[model samples]
Target: MSALLEADALHLRFGAVRALDDVAVSIWPGEVVAIVGESGSGKSTLLRVLSGQVAPDAGGVRYAGAEVHALGEAQRRRLMCTDWGYVHQNARDGLRMGVSAGGNIGERLMAAGTRHYGAIRDAAAEWMVKVELDPARMDDRPGMFSGGMQQRLQIARCLVTQPKLVFMDEPTGGLDVSVQARLLDLLRRLVGELGLAAFFLTHDIAAARLLAHRILVMRHGRVVEEGLADRVLDDPRHPYTQLLVSSVLAA
Candidate 1:
């Protein structure tokens, strides 16, 4: 498959810290690529650059064969609204606490030019069911929900627009283990059913293994190893990657 998103020779720096260095990666349609490493390893930085949230000091990002950075701010925003979704590590960051769950999902539909209230409401309810949330709770505010519920609602909101690609940052990071497992299962199912491509960042090897088809291990702003998820996690080649895999196994 051709690449839906590509980052070439990416480099970024914050003062003396190099957040990304010559990072090159690609994501194809219906694929999930995970960037995994310890904190400060530049995994998040890479995600930001790839998603066009941050411009690299030296490099380029392309989406669907167009230079992403070359687009005007309004164009970029419109592209993000229509073709891409971003799920932040914190549900609060992705969700509007004051808005009803259905309202949150419907807002994206409206942004995408849906004007009929009934259709928007129906779509939001349908997405709620898909994410395992009760459609009856669609009127409740996100602040009234649990952390896991908020995250699920966030996912529903993002997917309701049928975005071709989604960017997620440590999606399960703050949840309880059992909740995380359920969310992961739901996410896997949604990704498969929708045929959506995803670029996810995580420090958890198990999360990467469960959700990612391909894994890129980063350290010191550089990718130390990358391969199929099973290969990279089971028999990591780089010492850093080996240590990451072993630590997860030992836990």
Candidate 2:
């Protein structure tokens, strides 16, 4: 598989805090890669940078052999809006509370210059079904939905554009255990069926194991270990990775 996204020697700082330090990783087409670490380890920062939401102080981000920052604003917006989908850690950030479900999904199409209401409504309904959201609630506001339903709506909205690359920040975070399992299963199936490349950030070791084709374990803003999921999870080389795996197994 070709490299869909690449980050090299990434460095970022927020005054006295170093958010990322010389971080590097590459995501392949049609694969799911997870970046896992404890809080403040720069996992979320890396996702933000990769998705072009934040610029790094130094280093490079390349998508399909083209520099992300070097692209013009219009071009970046086009690519990120159509070819990429971003799911933030906070589900609320991923949704439009005031709009109906159909409106939320239609927003992506609107950004892509589609104006026909019929087309937008049909596309929205199709995608909502794809994400397992009921078409019956298409007119309901996000606030009217349950937490799990809101997350589902958010996923439906992001994916309506059929993005090639998706950046998911703790996608199953803040959900009940049952909801998390169901969502994880949905993600796994969608990635496999659509051949979508994903870069997901998470703290759940089992979530990583279940969904990621590869794992990048981070500590203190740097990736301490990276490898195939089974190898990394079953036989972690780094001390921190080992500890994480052991703790997950113990729990």
Candidate 3:
């Protein structure tokens, strides 16, 4: 099967700091790949570049078969609204806080040209249940929800359109430890049920272990290790990767 998303030899720099240096990645349909790294390690930058939110200074990104960076802004936006989904690390960035939860999900359906109000609402309610959110609270605004609830709402909004590929940046970050595990479980179930291709950035090795089939360990704008998630984490080859594992264990 062809890769659902592909990035090769990516190079991006901000002043003297290289955000990405000769990075390459690919995701197959129904497969999940996690990019794991510390802060400023370029995992998030790579995600943005792959999602077309930021254009790389060099190299190529293709989704399905189209050249991602070459597409017009409107085309890229349209692709995001329809075929691709992005879950922000912060729920606030991905959702309109003022809108009710149902409306948030409905908006994606609307973007896809769904005109029937009943159908949109029904789909929204169904997704709310799927994400472990109460459909009864669909009328509540994100600001009225807890942090975990807000994050789940953001996810519902993303998946409502049944995107083929989803890019998630630290989806389980910035949450209480207890909540993170539940959210990760929900994400794993959703990804499996939908058979979606996923690329996510995370510092939580446990999250990567639970969700990703493959893992990429990054440092200083380059991928230092790549392999099956278990192999990379169990017997990390690079000294940096080994340090990452040891640090997790020491915590």
TM-score of each: 0.98, 0.96, 0.98
lDDT (Cα, tens digit) per residue for candidate 1, span 137-178: 999999989999999999998988899999999999989999
141-225 in candidate 3: lDDT tens per residue? 9999999999999999999999999999999889999899889999999999999999989999989999999999999999999
CA lDDT, candidate 1, residue 242: 80
lDDT for residue 99 in candidate 1, whole number 0-100: 95
RMSD of each: 0.9, 1.4, 1.0
- TM-score computed on alpha carbons, candidate 2: 0.96
In model 2, the Cα lDDT at residue 27 comes to 86
Q: After superposition, how far is residue 85 of candidate 3 from its true place, in Å?
A: 0.6
Candidates sorted by lDDT, best first: 3, 1, 2
Candidate 1: minimum summed lDDT over ten consecutive residues — where?
242-251
lDDT of 2: 0.90
Best by lDDT: 3
Per residue, candidate 2 scores C-alpha lDDT tens digits across 1-251 of: 67888889999998888899999999888989999999999998888888777899999999988899888888999997789998876779988888899999999889977889999999999988888888998999999988887888888888888899999999899999899998899889888988999998999999998999999999888999999998999999999999999887455
